[model samples]
Target: MLKNKNLIMIFREIKVGELVDFVNTVFYKNANIVPITPQRAISQANNPYAQPNDVALVLALNNKEEIIGFIGILPGKTMLTDERFFWNTCWWIDPEKGKIAAMPLFYSMLKITKSNLIFFDLTPHTASIVAKMGFMTNSITGTKVFLRFNLNQILPKKYAFLAILKPILKFFDSCLNTMFAKKSAKKELNYQVIKCFDASMEVFLSKFKPTMLTPFDNTFFTWISNYSWLTTQPNEFETAIAKKYYFSYITQSFVVELLKITHQNEFIGIVVVTCRDSEMKIPYCFFDDNATEKVLEAIFNYAYNKKITTITTFHPKIKEQLKLKKNTVLFTKQLVKHVGYPKQFETLGITNKLFQDGEGDAVFT
Candidate 1:
């Protein structure tokens, strides 16, 4: 169909000044890009590490430019601290011009940079088209359930039982694992993880009041709390109040995770992900760059001590900051993934697999 079209589709980079305007015009008819705070947007553009990508365009190969389709592409893992590389409204094209005419411009975009995946977030319209372009659909069993490991919340109040009931619990776990492997017994099985609450977390939430947070809320809370000078105040009460509100927002938005950290103190800086159970058939755990090779050691230690099977959640590796680190209890970065097993997606019922972004839009990134 594009062969018959005469319009010469030319792709080019968008000027920083016009990025917001272009994003608005492109997604206006579909989803929204209006909620991103102006302050956050500017910070990204000014960051030294921010990867460059197309932000706007002068429609058609024209000089006196007017944008018809606006798109933003961001570098994966590495990005400007404040700037978000959007899977923006790249599909924005004039309907009258026809899909055949518009698609070439979209095709031209891959030349700018490669993305791990192009999310057909709003328009399922492009799914078939993009998939045909070589993007493989993930298997239904490949989906994951996001379990937030709230450092202070959801901890089992009864660690004493694990000691006294060790033998009985071990037998129970063995039976449950055996049954869980058989598809026939899977329907009636439930495996609850060991949980331990952080007293500091409980105290902090009580003193402060902030916005509700998702699993990603921990980092964002730290970021947004900087918005006000409250964090710098000398009064512990004032600071605690602000943080309390922030923590409350988190509990309301995301589910608590099922694990406990190796160390419960904050005297040092070591960030690690601990695992206690798996909602899916497999165990899942993640670590940041700072965790270094020590995280592996910690995981092995924990698994050995507990006598449990474990699997590490795969993420692009980063610096290991958790070394002085004994397996410290708090996590500093947001680890995201598709929800549920891929079977749910294959059956076309992957609703719970979706998540709302920090800014309030349901995004699949």
Candidate 2:
């Protein structure tokens, strides 16, 4: 336990009861925090990353024993090196306590784990603070690119004039699409996109060579599927070839669409897109170089047909190729940082590995 004159900090694994209480008291009450059901809380408590008898949650309270802030940690292991790391997630501090309150909670997490901490999906403000805290920012950050499918819908009401320009934009966009379209046309191919996972999907994923910062394997995929609230649910009547996908519109603000891409009756890839409001973000895409363009074309067509305003991705290769197409915009660059020994990272030689959006809990959101 660490304490200041006005603040009290405790370092311990969160229990199931406390987890439920926090969800009801803090998450349910706050619009910012995503509410978790009792079952989901139990799943989090028993997650592979959690220490026995404790979910990796750190809490801060005032003299009245009221919860003021918390930091959730998800345990992870490097596939190549098997190095254990705690992924920092859902960090928050009550605005009333001021920014300084975050320091104690962060320091407490470090003290408790005494291991490497990986921070992904950091905003500019949080990135600056973590950099000052002795965390090394990865030189290879994630790239993001956006393609506006429905220009008129994306334009704000105040910029209604932009609606008139939509036709011009679409004309230019079509020209660019034609210029970048694949030259070689094969036989009229049939592509199947479904929401489900089966043994066949697992077999396809096995062939995936993880070139990202995070090592993803069967264990990681299985762990991710357990969060029904955060991820797409399996369809009850799904066949061996197709799995059903479900999302809670009321509770889950975001929807993860897992599309198993197949061509000519063969598994080509899997594309996972998270949709929120008018924007759709591609967090994970597993396909070969040959299928990259095809998969992307399928996604773009789907988005357009669905009237999705924007489609975005953090994959460098995808972003690079999309930039060549008309109306594709480079939105922003995300910085990834870690609180670990420099020598360890150097030894791993994965500092420059490619990072995707769905690499961590970023997919869940």
TM per candidate comes to 0.32, 0.68
Indicate the residue-level lDDT of 324 in model 1: 32
lDDT of 1 by residue, 1-365 (tens): 12224544444555445554544454322321122222224433442323444343323332223233434443222111222333332345544443443555655555443333234333344655555666534321122222223212222224644465555665665665454421121222122233333454434333222221123324433332222211222354333333422111111121223333233242111222323332111122333334335444444343334333322332223213322333332223333332211122333333322222212212110
Which residues of candidate 2, in runs, are more than 4 Å off?
1-18, 21-43, 46-54, 98-100, 139-191, 194-200, 210-212, 215-253, 263-266, 327-343
| Poorest stretch of ten by lDDT in candidate 1 | 246-255
Error of 2 at 2 (Å): 4.5
Best-performing candidate as measured by TM-score = 2
Q: What's the alpha carbon RMSD for model 1?
A: 17.8
Best by lDDT: 2
Number of residue pairs clashing in candidate 1, backbone atoms closer than 3 angstroms, sequence gap of 3 or more or interchain: 40
